[model samples]
Target: MDVDIEDILAELNTDSTAVDQSGNPFSDINNNNNASTLYNESSSYPETNLKTNATSTSIPSPQQDYNNLIILWRNERCAPELLPYPHNLMTRMLSRIQEQMERLEIISMDFLGQQHSTTTTDTTGNNPVNNNNMLPLLCMEAELERIKFVIRSFIRCRLSKIDKFSLYLRQINEENESISPLQDFLSKDEMIYYESHSEILLKLFNDTILKHLPPNMQAINDNTGTVPMIDEPDWNKFVFIKVIGPQNKIFNTDPILIKGDNGKWYYEVIIPELQERVELIIDSIYVMRYKVIKDLLMEGKVTLI
Candidate 1:
């Protein structure tokens, strides 16, 4: 077959003009170019790939949660006057008490001076008839009345303040129950006032209620191997045990053991013979090491006979 090269070139040119002049195919070509550019850009810089890996953490234990709860309670519950009450009632009560105490002290001092003066005057046989009996009794009675008044006033003031504080606390508790979880009624100023009031209340509570409690109730001094005991004469006494040699091992041989209701063991040893009780003050580090050993044994971290 005889090929016509000129004819074939002419046909190709005609097809190209037809494709471009129609506008549809030409626009399709431009759209494909734009689509290609967009695809390339999107693939080159992927949005999902830019994200960091998410990390999962374990939740805290129940004991840790409980401790957090207690801390929050201490922070929030200590100040009752800030939310609702006779405003600055605690401050007023404290000031009144102090003033009354001062007055009582002054009255006591004056009475004491008067008595001393009278006794001295009588010793010198210079007792005036008026000073001997009537004046002293009258003065003493007046001092007594003043003291009684102060005492009664102090008691009444304290009672009133306490009653008001209690009522406010109850209101707060009720408000807490009724309010929405998302709602916060306390303003910035109120929060600041509450914080200061809380600190004052904490100090007062510690000085008054906490101080009067038995020492064992206030703090757990595990450093001093003092195991609380019941049905024993010296229940509060700390027990000590003597280690003879510089050895790391604790043994059962002649080891003084103070056992509690919880089956916890403490060493009991008498020091300075004259001292009535046996008490040992263990270093915190040693106590911690001992605790680790104990925990290891309990948890099967170490095998023992």
Candidate 2:
């Protein structure tokens, strides 16, 4: 029997045929369209998965490979080579470097020692007697003597060297006490006394020797009325003096009046109202020479006697 197209269409339109066993005939058509699209995509892009796997397993680039090769070559070149027992080239190189460093340290230490020796010789006049280095020794001795003369003339006191050094140490100790833990050992009054004495000495030093003594002369004689022989007046006994004028002016060659039989010097004028008697001493003469009297003496305004 021949099938009719109209009947087949009618059967497809029926509810039982249109609906699936689970009541969804359209679901089957949608699934088939999706499968067709997926098949077409897979065919068109055949190497997609292969391309992904290849990218994941890729090796380093040419530049990176070159850099790695260079590093490997360096490692091989620097690698320690095996040597005979008890003799390693790498160890020998390290030992040589260490020896050179030691030698440099020794040279530096010797140079420092020489410098210190030179400085000490310059200051103390005790030249090192390395007969091999005679020129440096002579130079050092000459320089030291020059420095000693300058110090003696400018800074040495009429007091003994020991006394002067003691005073200096005391002054230094007092100054250090401000920052030192040894402050507890010094009494407050002692510190104050040192400071006051130091100030007075500084003023006197500035006014006298520093101001008056000729640059070339180590000793200055300040006796008036006829130059006395060295035996007549003891040079060592002379004390430093400074003569102050009104308004901070100072007098040079300040007249020193020798008292009768006492061999003492006093100021010419005694102000009973102030109960102050000015005195003239070596220091006074020195200061006066620089501050006031030099000009007057040069002008013949005043005579020393």
Best by lDDT: 1
Residue 67, candidate 2: how far off, in angstroms? 70
Stretches of candidate 2 off by over 4 Å are: 1-132, 157-305
Residue 102 of model 2 has an lDDT of 50
Tens digit of per-residue lDDT, candidate 2, span 3-78: 2335323322321121211111111112331323222111122223422322212222212222222222222222
| Cand. 1 TM to true fold | 0.19
The lDDT of model 2 is 0.32
| Model 1 ranges off by over 4 Å | 1-84, 123-305
Evaluate residue 255 in candidate 2 and report its C-alpha lDDT on the 0 to 100 scale.
44
lDDT of 2 at 78: 23
lDDT of each: 0.33, 0.32
Q: Which ten residues in a row have the lowest lDDT in candidate 1?
A: 20-29
